[model samples]
Target: MNNQTITNTHRDTSLGYKLGVFGVVITLLWIGVFKFTPTEAAAIEPLVVNHPLIGWVYNFISVQMVSNIIGLTEIIIAIGLIVGFFNSKVGYVSGILALLTFITTLSFLATTPNTWKMVDGVLTTNFFLLKDIVFISISLLVIEHNKKYI
Candidate 1:
């Protein structure tokens, strides 16, 4: 409405954008590092076991192996995203990874909703998977905002 109000709004949105990128960097890097560990690999076993899209990875490679690859990729992507903060090209690539990661995780809701369990008819999995939606939204925003640079 007013110039001052518009300026404040713009500033707030900019801060939110920066924070979102930082959050994604921290979260993905932390989780990505752990993905290589036995604990993290075991933790995702059930989710992977029931997954329809990528579950077959276990059939070709051991779960641990698959987890290792995923972890390494995440680390690389995290690095790229950090670079993206300064370099739009790298950021674009990391943005693609973020989009794919969240989309895949969200797909889990449909492929293996049973893993999340249902109580009173509502799937508990929705709660767990819903977080991906937020992450995806952040990724989408990052992508949209970066389109000008790309």
Candidate 2:
């Protein structure tokens, strides 16, 4: 490819990366804030209660408190990701956290009951969780992109 073409392609790739990070940040921020609401807390109760690893949290705290803690964690992660732009170490840590976040959410697909259903002959599951796969990919990319700086 020509030098100009290569430059354009690189620019586009960089823009796409920025957009992906922005998307993840926005999603996490929005969902994290929503987690503070009673509606979201109740909605997630079933999934959270069914998880093998974290289900015990409900045993010690009220559902709303659990949701609040999760929300706070997410907000912190989002801030970490933002700061990561300037500090590679922070970015790497945030990327790993983001990766873990997505992975944990994806796990709900298997841990949560009745997550799958046959709809019109096609087996479907909680489509919301499926997006985490893409988020996970972005998190990995974020890690790789920051590794050079670290």
Candidate 3:
């Protein structure tokens, strides 16, 4: 490719990457804030309660508190991701955290009861959890991009 073409391609890729990162950051921040609400807390109860690693949290704390804690963690991760835009080391760590977040979310597909069902001879699962696959991919890309600077 000519110099101009290569430069254009690089610019386009960078824009796409920025958009993906922005989407993830927005999603995490919005969901994290929503977790503080009673409705969101209740909605997530089933998933949290069923989680093997985090289910025990409910034993010592109220449902709202548990949700609050998760929400706070998500907010922190989102902030870290934003900062990662300027700091590669922070970005690498934040990307890893974001990756783990989605992996754990995807695990809910298996851990949560009634998450999967057979519909009209087709196997269907919680479509919401499926979105995490894209998030995971983005997180990986973020990690890869930042790794060059670390």
Candidate 4:
């Protein structure tokens, strides 16, 4: 191959590796957050202000069980992505989940009362949603480029 072709190939490979690493890191970080952190403080109580839509859902349903189930599912998906198992399915599912979560967060922000009155407003401090968006984008890119690795 020509030098230009070689450089392009190398760049593409590097991007894939970087995206894969990002996916794994993000997966682990969320797993840690959900598994180790106090669910009440981190999710239930704070979500009232930070993610009121989710909070309302929590109030309307079995918050603890549903949250735990979701957390477990995330951990499983993350493991699959990190270990390179069924990556296409995982990538697509993860992307969908991330998108849904982001949309729900937006809905939560819109529905919450006096959302902007608090310094720790849901929209302002919702890095989880933003990070998920990044993760979803990188994951989709990695899957597109490294379908064989999956």
Candidate 5:
């Protein structure tokens, strides 16, 4: 027989977990960086304007200003994720932030239907937005895997 043993630590030691975390970290960092750019701000205008939860932000602050705030928050969360890898309190907060971010992203499906163009009577979403589902699962896994085992 082959030599392979699956245990509770499977998820912790599997390649999927490492790669998933790395990908999530990279994406979050990039999202944080993009929020500072003019193009990114302009690009997100539609999403912010259409969102029912936070769309009112435009009424109080300019899109660029809001974009900057989001960017800063994302940057902080990214740092938290890195620290969480080592078992820190901030890492816990990162898990919360990550979950919230993905929730917001998934909300886009209900808030902004235009983003998902209709093709052959099927509502098809862009890979960029749909990818949040994957991140959501990853964030959950990270939260569980990083928890202290005592």
Candidate 6:
């Protein structure tokens, strides 16, 4: 293709990608605020405090400010991901936030000690751990896929 045509094609692709990323970020943020429906209490029911380390982590993460900050930062990162589409600096920041989120999630899960007693005897903690893994994977995907556009 001619230079003009090639440049136009690239611009269109980049614009489309940026828009798509922005849309996804908005959807995720909305779901988190509305549909994810985090209760006033934590998602995991408290396990019997049999382990000291687990107990310590659990108590620490339960701080109101800590949880609130985590939630707020999640929203901020969503914004960053949307804006990051237009600039490399924002994209890198978003990636860093995602990594931080992964770390926080790991600590949250680890602190809980054990899953609630399910009637069917299914271990639910594994499900949460898997979800966190998926979150990390998506963060990586965002970083990898949009690095070029950013």
Worst 10-residue lDDT window, candidate 4: 83-92
Alpha carbon RMSD to native, model 6: 6.2
Per-prediction TM-score to the true structure, in the order listed: 0.82, 0.90, 0.89, 0.52, 0.83, 0.57
Please give the CA lDDT of all the candidate structures.
0.77, 0.88, 0.89, 0.51, 0.78, 0.56
lDDT of 6 by residue, 65-98 (tens): 3335445666788888876555556766786777
The CA-based lDDT of model 6 is what?
0.56
User: What are the clashing pairs of model 5?
Assistant: none
- TM-score of candidate 1 relative to the true fold: 0.82
Who wins the TM-score comparison? 2
- Candidate 2 residue runs with Cα over 4 Å from true position: 1-13
What tens-digit string does per-residue lDDT give for candidate 1 at 27-145? 88898899989998997777777788789889889889988887887788778777866666677778888889888877877776455676899756557667778889888887776
Off by over 4 Å in 3: 1-13
Winning model by lDDT: 3
Candidate rank order under TM-score: 2, 3, 5, 1, 6, 4
Residue 99 miss distance in model 4 (angstroms): 4.7
Give the alpha carbon lDDT tens digit for every residue of 49-148 in model 5: 8899888999999989999988888788888888766543556568778989888978877787477677999867756878889989988877776564
Give the clash count for model 1: 0
Clashes of each: 0, 0, 0, 0, 0, 0
By lDDT rank, best first, the candidates go: 3, 2, 5, 1, 6, 4
Name model 6 segments beyond 4 Å from true: 1-28, 31-38, 41-62, 116-122, 126-129, 146-150
TM-score, structure 5 vs. true:
0.83
lDDT per residue, candidate 2, 1-150, as tens digits?
A: 356654553454477888898899999999999999999999999989999999999999999999999998889888888876666678889999999999999999999999999999999998999999999999998899777656
Relative to the true structure, candidate 6 reaches a TM of 0.57
> What lDDT would candidate 3 get against the real structure?
0.89
